[model samples]
Target chain A: SAVISQKPSRDICQRGTSLTIQCQVDSQVTMMFWYRQQPGQSLTLIATANQGSEATYESGFVIDKFPISRPNLTFSTLTVSNMSPEDSSIYLCSVAPRLGNTQYFGPGTRLTVL
Target chain B: TQLLEQSPQFLSIQEGENLTVYCNSSSVFSSLQWYRQEPGEGPVLLVTVVTGGEVKKLKRLTFQFGDARKDSSLHITAAQPGDTGLYLCAGVGHNNAGNMLTFGGGTRLMVKP
Candidate 1:
């Protein structure tokens, strides 16, 4: 397990405003991922961030809406652009430390777009 | 897209009871993992099973992967109030080794004291 921390544990933002969430890991990792968990729903992958590369987003997600920055291996940021009520969800950051399919997650960022 | 189905989307039981959560999929997974999440927190990895017919135990919790690698089960014995939370099962279907994950609809468990 890894020690992962997310910034702005909870936030209330107005619609059309953008919010940036930061993820920091104690140890440098190779792969970092962002996920969205809707209220009462399971997690859905938003994007996969590898160091020195553009994030690969899932089908339902796009880079324009969720811009990701992975400037290093251990830290990354996800910006929710032009936020709406539908973007009100728990955003989580996770990392895969090894080749095995095990991942450790950080305490999520609870966002509410009013 | 690969889909994983978890049975009994909701489970409510009293302390000292045993419960099992099942995850099934038509597509075979390279590996499967189980996670438990509480409110205001992220999902925590409990265990991961890679081989077919493999079983792993953590204290009172037992996880088993089916022979065909398309299904799995998590059984908890002597459930306690602290065991209440959302249980999720995720699978890696592609051969990229941990690059991607497809999660199943979670099972909400409530163990009342």
Candidate 2:
């Protein structure tokens, strides 16, 4: 199992401000993913953070709003730019096991835009 | 678009009661996973069903995949307070490999003492 750590466990940002969340994995991983979970809702995949490449985002999401970067196999960052109250949600980073597709997730970053 | 539809969006029951959550889709998948997430924590993998008609048991939880690989179910026997959380089912898209996952809306189960 892989352990992941995310910085800024909780933050209160003013509207229009930007916040970057960092994810650091204890070991190298083949795949890393970013997810968002609204209060009382399930998790939604935001993008797939690729090593040395632009993240692949899902429908209803765009890179300009939620820019992501995977500098290496064990590290990635997600920046929520021009934030609004609606963007307040728990952001999580996950690392997938090499052999199977099982994912290990970070504790999560809870952001509340005021 | 691939989607997983889960039933009973919210459930509340007394401890020791039994309940089952369903996850269905029109598309087939190579693998399906069950996860339970607490209030402020990321989801924890409960079990993974990879083959059609597969059944896996973890403690008091039982997971079953449909014969067609288009659906799955989770049954909890003798529920406890710790069982209260958001239950989610995710599957790998049939056409994609590790690219994306279609997650069920989720079943929020609250077990009362």
Candidate 3:
């Protein structure tokens, strides 16, 4: 399992602002994914971030709203732009290491949009 | 697009009781994984069942995959208050990403001592 960490474990932001969540993995990985878990809901894939390429957003998720950056194999960032109350959710980053089909997740960034 | 439906959306049981949680899907999955999540923390993977009709046990928790690969079940024996948490079932999807996961609605379990 990879040791993953997300910065600013929790945050409070006003509507219309943006916050960038960083995910750092202990080892270099090729596949990094961002997922959102709404209050009392399941996890939904927001995007797939691969280093040296553009992030692929999932259905109903626009790149404009959830911009992602995979600057390196071990680090990625997801920026929630133009936030709204509906965007209040736990944002998590997962890494699929080179060895297996399993993924390891970060503690998650809990965002509260006011 | 595949979807996984979890049964008994919420379960509250007393300690020492046994309970089962189900995850069903109309579409087959290449693999299924079970995870337990506590407040303010990310889900911790419990077990992964790949082959159909396979059963794996971890301590007091048992995980089984259906023969058709479209369903799975998790049974815990002699449950303890420490077992209380949100249980999630995720199926591995065949996608370009290779390991894309389709998560179930999730079962929130509360065990009272």
DockQ order of candidates, top first: 3, 1, 2
Where does candidate 2 clash, by residue pair?
Answer: none
- lDDT of prediction 2: 0.90
TM-score of chain B of each: 0.95, 0.94, 0.97
Expressed as tens digits, the lDDT of each residue in B1-113 for candidate 2 is 87899998999999999999999999888889899988778888888898999999999999999999999999999999999999999987632336456789999999999
Report, for every candidate in turn, its global Cα lDDT versus the true structure: 0.92, 0.90, 0.93
User: Candidate 2 versus the native: TM-score?
Assistant: 0.96
Q: Write the residue-wise lDDT of candidate 1 on A2-104 in tens digits.
A: 8999998999999999999999999888789999999999999998886887888888899999999999989999999999999999999999876553688
TM-score winner between 1 and 3, please give it: 3
Q: Kindly provide the TM-score obtained by chain B of candidate 3 when compared with the true chain B.
A: 0.97
lDDT of 3: 0.93
Report, for candidate 1, the interface RMSD: 2.1
For candidate 1, the TM-score is 0.96
What are the per-residue Cα lDDT tens digits for candidate 1 across B1-113?
89999988999999999999999999998989999999999999899899999999999999999999999999999999999999999997543324677899999999999
List RMSD in Å for every model shown: 1.4, 1.5, 0.9
Residue B73 error, candidate 2, Å: 0.6
Residue A51: error of model 1 in Å? 1.3
* Best candidate, DockQ: 3
> Lowest summed lDDT over 10 consecutive residues: which window, candidate 2 chain A?
A96-105
Docking class of 1: medium
